[model samples]
Target: MLWPTNYTKLASATMFTLFFAGATFAPKRMVNGENIQHFLQRHYCNAYKYLASRLRHLDAVIGFEVMNEPHNGFIGLKDLKAYHPTETLGPR
Candidate 1:
């Protein structure tokens, strides 16, 4: 996939990248006294809770899963500002 043109536009740009940056990219600390990963997780939990509260009474709605296909966004990279991956492959 083509890399995004703007890397720092986290809120409205690529969501998967944002998920990685917010959820799992480490050196886990606080920005302005807020742990962003936990903040993101709390939002997910709250959404699930809201859905469960509304749907638990129904017989067919049997389950819920959060963080579907969670990705390690930029977790192991040695450099943050440079595009490192040199290749991409399509269906063979």
Candidate 2:
């Protein structure tokens, strides 16, 4: 019977390199704040509208994520107004 010798060493080395690299270079964490959801929603909506207009085929893309962390507590009509008194809260 014939056996391949290089495969095991190659796999082991690749795995070790990836593990160490990930440990050494972790991704930056995001900070959460009360008005962060509203801020993100406002900016993303503008961007999405622009993109949809330019790429007419994507007009159906009407939804967006507020943030990776959903601020359910900060996502109410009164809370939104309190955060940005100048801005009016639209339909929920």
Task: Give the top-scoring candidate (TM-score).
Answer: 1
- Clash count (model 1, backbone only): 0
Which stretches in model 1 have alpha-carbon errors above 4 Å?
1-33, 81-92
Q: Tell me the spans in candidate 2 whose CA falls farther than 4 Å from its real position.
A: 1-34, 57-92
**Model 1 agreement with the true structure over 1-92: per-residue lDDT tens digits:** 34442332333223444444654543365556666666656677899999899998899887977654343445454665653332311111
What C-alpha lDDT does candidate 1 achieve relative to the native structure?
Answer: 0.51
Best by lDDT: 1
TM-score of 2: 0.25
lDDT (Cα, tens digit) per residue for candidate 2, span 1-92: 11222222334323322332322232231225323334444566788778667767676766556333222222233543344322322212
For residue 1, give model 2's deviation from the true position in Å.
Answer: 39
lDDT (CA) per prediction: 0.51, 0.37
TM-score of 1: 0.54
